[model samples]
Target: MNKKVILSTVLFLSACGGSDSGDGISLNKVKSNDKAKCSNSRLDSCYYDINQLALNIMFRKNDTGVLNVTASVSGPKQDIYFTGSDVLEIHADGEVFLPTNNGADSLRYENIPDNAQIYEFFWYRNSQLVEYNSIDGITEPSVILSTSQHDGSNTITTDWLNNPDYTYQIHTPSLWCTNLNYESEMFSPSTGILDNQRPPYQATLQALYGKNIESLKVNYRSCDISVTLIAKNNQVNYRNKQKRLFIHHDNFSEHPLTLFESN
Candidate 1:
């Protein structure tokens, strides 16, 4: 195997709905030659570059009552739980670039701005940005909306440790799921407004709310960014030398599911 320094300058980004050259990242970067497992096995390509990455962006409130925003990234390279790296960063909305600290096997950031309209994740080495492979997706909020568990047991049996498993909503402009309200219970969330604008906020508005959302002047502390654009954030490597720079991008957030299902 004659490996040479190629200084590959191509960048790759794919998310939610998978992509081919026609709709998403360029197909030239996706030469499926390596048979090794990718960080995201769901993707169909191997022998790729931008080795193992799993990023989970969550918007929740910490104990101090401030919104806690975190992007947890791991390098599941080869079979190990981490990848070799030095730095990580985020591109918030337009040209704003935010740097984050990296641990041995993971990348993380917090204190994200409430007004940040959209965000893109990236990995860096030696101060320059590098592409990532197989983003393991965000943890989209799940609510037990409308269930039969309350047929007389889970809801009425009061001597409980957690909140009653009942049908309620935590509403964003588009998402009616969890509440920003916190009852004086142990790690339980009340049903009310969404605390932050998450990636799914806008889609919730269009799917269930009216078509005149922009005209309605609805305000949220968080911004609902499209998952499709979550992968829309890609960057080029600046280094002039490299041993192996294969190419691939994986954003697995587009798994199909019913927003609401009735029992």
Candidate 2:
């Protein structure tokens, strides 16, 4: 697949809401956390303060593989999604085949690290090696492989080039900060005392797809905030949930507290 084409498709989806389902499966709401107390008299009542949202996918292949995806408010107006995928595989004598071709190549058996399991082969358009993880073992043109931490957690680590010019490396870690600022402006009232004090926020992106990703969707107040980036990870995992809170003081008067993502 063309990298630019894939990136563009993901970005377009992030910007515009689509059919909400792909690859012959429909997405079902798994969980949500929404809590914003505003009476009918409040101007912000039109918006819903979101706490948390998550989606879980279970493949029909077997009970051993699953994907857990979560999204949370990072600032007054911003939200971030984190996802993780778990897969189980078969290895012969603790050795697995690592393929070099983009699905057309042959797999060569090698002694992989105890912590590493042959998953799939990652390739650039030219078929250069990018990374491999366990999920790739099941994907077409399986060139990428994935290895997990072996702690029974979904955390998997793979080799990714850190070159500055690499598109995926440029936007990560910084996009979280940039998103916080962008969201503050969007959620602030255009005219009011609260306008001057936009709520503060922050966000983090986790990769569930094994490689870096580019598009994400955040939900706030029944509205979805689409985030398109120069680069991002395929999924994100957090030791702790990303949280944001907003405080407004108008002419020496303080408004009640507002939480970004409720527990």
Candidate 3:
């Protein structure tokens, strides 16, 4: 299916078959990141901050087990919506002010459910749907993450375990990082293009359905082995000068169990 269709399917699947709470969730203190550099008035900064805000709420829900979350985010983009069962609205002008290259834009979420398994964010540019982020596999209370620019181009599936230092093995076009006391690890290269010659960290990854995937299935370590679908991208290798896919093995050692998926 196409990327748009895949995104729509992801949203539909996330919204279906989940326990709902009667108490709604809310978000407060929404502020855009003014400290960011934006050629187009801080697209990356604005987008990143808002996205981070949503993720922060998700993690908070996991930790506290609160049924509703009320938080706010500020960034460059305006007319943004955080969609799940209900919508978290964004307002362009708010009470707070920040020192940004662009003007301050604020948003807030009222009564967000702690049991919300999926989150989809829609961002607009010139009244057009420029980008959207779909977060799924959040049923478990462990850390949650969707794909980001930092992941380069690989589709990824991540797991966080209570016990650490476990050796993991998966098929190629796949890599596992272990041998440390990290509670979280991510595995990839599951049903996508594989470029063996390139280093794992430098490779550009893609999703199975489309390039620049906005939807992902998140899971905890239910089994010893799991598979993830890598998305598409055009990152090249400097040494070989060829387009390739690589493996990523990140063991978040030296840090306690905190979610690093937002960066």
Best by lDDT: 1
TM for candidate 2 is 0.14
Q: Per-residue lDDT of 108-130 in model 3, one digit per residue for the tens?
A: 33334433334434333322222
**lDDT per residue (tens digit) for residues 77-182 in model 1:** 4332222333344443343333343332222345444345444444444333343332222222232223222221111110111122221122322222222332
Go through the candidates in order and give the clash count of each: 8, 27, 34
| Prediction 3 global C-alpha lDDT | 0.28
Backbone clash pairs in model 1 (N, Cα, C under 3 Å; residues 3+ apart or in different chains), count: 8
Checking candidate 1 for backbone clashes, the offending pairs are: 16-254, 49-246, 49-247, 170-177, 170-178, 174-204, 174-205, 197-222
> How would you order the candidates by TM-score, starting with the best?
1, 3, 2
User: What is the TM-score of each predicted model, taking all chains together?
Assistant: 0.29, 0.14, 0.23
Ten contiguous residues minimizing lDDT sum, candidate 2:
246-255
lDDT score for residue 210 of model 3:
32
Candidate with top TM-score is: 1
Which runs in model 1 stand beyond 4 Å of their true positions? 1-51, 61-65, 75-86, 93-100, 104-106, 125-154, 157-263
* lDDT (C-alpha) at residue 224 in model 3: 21
Residue 59, model 2: lDDT of 13
Runs in model 2 lying further than 4 Å from the true structure? 1-117, 120-184, 187-263
How much lDDT does each candidate structure score?
0.31, 0.21, 0.28
